[model samples]
Target chain A: MERIPILKMGKFLIVSIQVDMHDELALALQEDLAEQIVKTRAKGVLIDISSLNLVDSFTARILGNMTAMARLLDAETLVVGMRPAVAMTLVELGVSLRGIRTAGNAEKGMALLEAIVAQQAKSNAPKST
Target chain B: MPPKVRDTFTVRSDHDVVTVRQKARQLATELGFSLVNQTKLVTAVSELARNMVVWGGGGTVRMEIVKNGALQGVRLTFEDHGRGIPDIEQAMKDGYSGGSGLGLGLGGAKRLVDEFDIVSRVGKGTRVTITRWK
Candidate 1:
């Protein structure tokens, strides 16, 4: 079985989708990301789709599901680098990708993720009385 | 002028779905469709092709380069001989799904293209034909 590589960077996991993923591959990525989140105790997951040209409802649903799953596991998932054409198509296709955060590119996405993690840490920090 | 070109592909597995999307993208690009139009057509193809693999239990897709007057376009026909849709009206709704999908396949695909037509018979199969002009 083929798998998309998930790179762990400190408290974040980055997945760059470079292939035209099939249905099974997308599902596998979802499951694999969940397991990795638990194992690594990661705080954020960044999915870069700049190399992908199209995102159908099936893929969109998987992405949406991934974000939901990651949320339950206490992680933030940010999908970045969507092509302008793909974004137009997604809206016309009526897949809102609800509950999923997005950024223009990986750098911006990373910065946003850092901010989110920092915010979370600040809130989670115990009072030093 | 060149004659119309038609090609057929089988949609039996997940890989086939990706192939269909690629082929559709190629055809749309060759027809000089704008980038956004190409994406929309390819995305629509992805949805319909996956429908054949997941719900229809495999099928065939026919890609045709069509011309009308001076306009060029790509037309695709997806046929599947699996369990046919019982209620197409409900299935076309955005939130309706007979399987584990977002129920946006048919309606969404239709929205992305310029022309859409569907024919289905219970206990038989379904055929969807769509076209996008450039």
Candidate 2:
């Protein structure tokens, strides 16, 4: 089965979706990403959907589910590169993607991921007695 | 007004939904719909196609590149002989799904297209038709 590639950069895992993903493929990515997050102990997951022009309800839900799963594993998921049309359709489709964070591009997404991870670390740090 | 092109594809599984979406994009683009319109059509087809498979057991999607004088549009008819919807009004309302979905399938699809129609008979089947004009 064809699969989406996951690249590791520092403490983050970057996934660039370049194909019109089938439902199974999207589900597979969700599973693969969760596993990679645990294996690498990654702090953040950056999903780049710049090349994607359309996203259906099921795909949107899978994206949301991925971020929620990552959160359970102590990682943050940031999605980037959403086309304006896709964004509009997503809103009309009533998929809020509540827990997933979105950015305009990979640079901004990476920066957002870094800030979120830093915030997590700061919160988890032991308070001075 | 007659359609310049018409075709039908089966929607038996999730993979078939992808096929339906690709065909919708191609037809929508060829019909001179803008990128935004094309995306909306494709997304609407995806949602309805998935509903056909997950809720209706399986079905078929018919696509037509229609023309009414100077206006060109895409029309899609989804038909299934599986379990039909009982309360269409409630189903058309958001957040009402008999299956394990977000319940946005019917209402959201209706919003994407310019024209929408649905008909179903209890214990028989369901038919949903949507059209987007350019």
Candidate 3:
């Protein structure tokens, strides 16, 4: 797994989460982040939670909400690089995923997002016109 | 918000939720719940406890272990007598926060546990109970 530093790719909200994010703060940020993505009509999103310590119920809910909002705006969200301990803590805290997809790292998430774009392109491409 | 506690567990701060979480987790484990399930229950309890303190104006995290037949799961009731919820349906909406603490949101907590119910009044208080059964 290669370390992919956070960068703005094309048109998407790239949030590199840290370990000390308060649950409320995270939730507030998600609202703004999701709104920005929707307002801009970004392609997709990559949330890097590699440094998160414990994603409590509130934080998890925000992530879940973000996923829903992104979908409403026709954008995909991929949670990337969640630590196993943090993930388990979140599970214990009963953080609902709300059907948001997850990935091992940023590289894979980006690749998957790009794949979706490619697939959409092929499907929507004109038939030999 | 303010709530009068009748029995077990005096909740002073939000951390008192740790006790509720500990007790609930143990009970869930004894009932043969998977580790994952136990964690979810604990988290739900924590949320309720926080709500009691934050929105309900600091009440109590009552832990009731019913030894009666047909009802075996450990039940946690967060009783708070603060300004009750004005609208439950709106409160359940995602990102509907109108308070000081993490919004003391109910939607996620409700989603985490097997059983969840709440009762409240505008000027009375709020009581939220959740249980996880195996």
Query: How should the candidates be ordered by DockQ, best one leading?
Result: 1, 2, 3
TM-score for candidate 2: 0.95
Native-to-model Cα distance after best TM-score fit, residue B120 in candidate 1, in Å? 0.4
Error (Å) of candidate 3 at residue A87 is: 3.0
* Span of ten consecutive residues with least summed lDDT in model 1 chain B: B1-10
The alpha-carbon lDDT assigned to residue B103 of candidate 3 equals 44
lDDT of each: 0.92, 0.90, 0.69
Residues A1-129, candidate 3: write the lDDT tens digits: 212233456866687876344344565676677667756778788898887644565567677877887888878889999877557756534444759899999899988988886787798889995
lDDT: the better of candidates 2 and 3: 2
Clashes of each: 0, 0, 7
Clashing residue pairs in candidate 2 are: none
lDDT of 2 at A92: 76
Candidate 1 clash pair list: none
Off by over 4 Å in 3: A1-7, A89-98, B1-46, B53-55, B59-134
Candidate 2, B1-96: lDDT as tens digits: 456548889899888998999999998887788888899889999989999998899899999877778888899999999889998999999888
lDDT of 1 by residue, B1-134 (tens): 55365799989998998888898988887778999999999998998888888889999999998888888889899999988999999888898775755889999999999999999998799999999999
Candidate 1 chain A weakest lDDT stretch, 10 residues: A52-61
Write the candidate numbers in order of decreasing TM-score: 1, 2, 3
lDDT of 1 by residue, A7-29 (tens): 99999999999999998999999
